[model samples]
Target: MASTRQIITDLRAQARALDGRHLSGSMMDGVCRSLRRGADELDRLLGELAMLRAFAEIPGDAE
Candidate 1:
């Protein structure tokens, strides 16, 4: 599994990659879909990260 920070870094790179590309209409649509998926994935990962941190903060949990 990837760390949340690395996934965010990759998403930023993908956003940067969208610049200066000569994409056809369909290709641009596909790229937009991919970016949307990435955004959704990032949201999920962030949620999981938050949950993990919350769980970790609880005292006296079994190891």
Candidate 2:
């Protein structure tokens, strides 16, 4: 699986491409919106994964 940071980075790149001149204004708007949504979702997933990892490791922690 790609890391959350990697996913977000890729999404940003996609957004940049959408903003480039080849895309029409309306199409660029749609693509940027979709990419933003994807980035948000990826961030949520990463947070959840971090919580789960912490939960799983708590029992063995000595401090």
Candidate 3:
């Protein structure tokens, strides 16, 4: 299981739960959107970092 996928899934679940709550106000909605955006950025950065690390594993200048 990719942790990035898990993180996204968890966040989506939490957002859904918040939507179901009686106090699901605009503030909470905005916060959730911001959190999702941040998570997305982190996920993108992680993918790039993974690729960079993988490339670094190659010996010499072939990488």
Candidate 4:
């Protein structure tokens, strides 16, 4: 699976590319909205990943 950071980066790039090119009602508008949602989701996932890693490193933590 792709790392959360990388997934966010890809979504940001897609959003940038779609910026300023969509009309009021077009497919690109939907694409842009989806990309924004994807980026937000990835950010949340990254936070979860960090918490998991920190929990794993607790002293006396089990495998």
Candidate 5:
């Protein structure tokens, strides 16, 4: 299975390919925007997960 980061990379590539083609007000334009937003969301999710992992790795007072 592909990792989240890898998926985001592919998504960004696809988005870039669809971008800036003067397809304003068209379905392809909408698709490109949606793909970009999806990638942005996934990136944020990865950051949140990494932050949680870092917190988990820290030494706790109870430990």
Candidate 6:
């Protein structure tokens, strides 16, 4: 499985590509929509990973 950091990085790159587009109309709209979805998913995944890491770091349990 890919790490959260790598997933976020890939999503950001996709967003950049969508933003750089010179097209107009439905195609551009579709790309932007896809980019937004990817970004939101990445954000959720990163948040979950952060919570898991925090739980793992708590003192007193297995290291």
Worst 10-residue lDDT window, candidate 6 = 54-63
TM-score of candidate 4 to 2 decimals? 0.66
lDDT (Cα atoms) of all candidates against the true structure: 0.65, 0.74, 0.67, 0.76, 0.79, 0.68
Q: Is candidate 2 or candidate 6 better by TM-score?
A: 2
TM-score, one value per model: 0.51, 0.68, 0.57, 0.66, 0.74, 0.52
The most accurate candidate by TM-score is 5
Q: Model 5 over residues 1-63: C-alpha lDDT tens digits? A: 788888999998998898766565555777788888999999999887777767888533221
Candidate 3 C-alpha lDDT tens digits along 7-54: 777877777666534563445676577667877887788777677777
User: What TM-score number comes out for model 3?
Assistant: 0.57
Writing each residue's lDDT as its tens digit, candidate 6 over 1-63 gives: 776567767877777777756564435656766867887887887677667878877543222
- Candidate order by decreasing lDDT: 5, 4, 2, 6, 3, 1
Q: Which candidate number maximizes lDDT?
A: 5
For residue 53, what is the lDDT in candidate 2?
A: 70
Give lDDT tens digits, candidate 1, residues 1-63.
Answer: 776657767776786677446566434546755775787788787777678867888433321
Worst window of 10 by summed lDDT in candidate 1: 54-63
What's the lDDT for candidate 1?
0.65
Off by over 4 Å in 3: 1-5, 20-27, 58-63
TM-score of 5: 0.74
lDDT pick, better of 2 and 4: 4
lDDT of 1 at 35: 71
Where model 2 places Cα greater than 4 Å from the true spot, the runs are 20-26, 58-63
* Candidate 4 Cα misplacement greater than 4 A, ranges: 22-27, 58-63
What is candidate 2's lDDT per residue for 1-63, written digit by digit as tens? Answer: 775688899998888777644543345777787898999888888777777778887532222
> Which clashing pairs does model 5 show?
none
